[model samples]
Target: MASTSSYSSSPCAACKFLRRKCMPDCIFAPYFPPEEPQKFANVHKIFGASNVSKLLNEVPPHQREDAVNSLAYEAEARIKDPVYGCVGAISVLQRQVMRLQKELDATNADLFRYTCNEMPTTQPAGAGIRRINEAAAGASSYPQSSVYYYNPSPWNNDLCGDGYQRGGDNNM
Candidate 1:
């Protein structure tokens, strides 16, 4: 009996979809470039030295110098310009703030766990009570949160919060 079945086994996903030789690291951390040029170059385009040099040359002279100098002063200044703007910088700062906030929250939680409910000295062994408490205290000393409001605080007006006067007085 002649079986007209086209159900043949295909190459592995790494080989077929990624178009690269199926390897362990490539399957896991595919974005990481291969150690040796040839192994990594297997599935990716290879740019010649001349092409890369040409691209470098195409960069503006000031930019090229800045890159070489390890001081991107002009680039930093451009980030503040209204025309160039700072959307990217602001996003990066936001991400950094979020990361710091997470760290702060984790430290505060550890501190509260060690101090608020239980006596300080009797905390479980290796609780890092002292260090966590110190870190939380330090973080609380700084006012890092940003609030933008034309009128006044969005929260209760009577309480004296950051950027607000005491006793619910706006004039103060």
Candidate 2:
């Protein structure tokens, strides 16, 4: 086994991004040391890299949510010039939002299984419900919106119930 002495002493953005304590014996040892300069160059390049426009373009619309959420977190952490603590708070907020979204998705899929008359203990998707329940019961505030409709039923057109079933007076 290779000792970790060399990497811990290097100056790479991975070390910097980790606030320095995550050095040596860490999983990134193999990618560090020899490539420290290259890693620093990549991170510094991000400073000058094109805006998240590339992620916007590259990611499919459905999968873009996470990337957009992460980009927004990066922005709030960096710009908007607030006092020191808010940046950290924004990171926490982003994580909370992502967790809530995941919980919601799991809840919907569980509801789908239940409505379809599948056994509650059915294999595969059923396992996710346990995780969803645990996450909902945890300290974070889970979204209270109804997953009882619009999902599982192919005919349900209301994506968000924000009122645009087939274009109406309130359509925007």
Candidate 2: stretches off by over 4 Å: 1-84, 118-147, 152-172
Residue-level lDDT tens digits of model 2 in 1-172: 2224465466333455445554454433333343444443342344322344354457775555465445444545445444543567767889998887766755665564444443234535542232222233333332345332424223333333333453223333
RMSD of each: 19.2, 19.2
Cα lDDT tens digits, model 1, 1-172, are 1112222233232244345454442221222232323322322223332343354467664454333222123233343553443556677889998887656555544444444433345555542223232333334332235311122232334221233434434453
In model 1, where do residues sit more than 4 Å from their true spots?
1-85, 120-172
Best by TM-score: 2
By summed lDDT, the worst window of 10 consecutive residues in model 2 runs over 127-136
lDDT of each: 0.37, 0.44
Clashing pairs in 1: 158-168
Scored by lDDT, model 1 comes in at 0.37
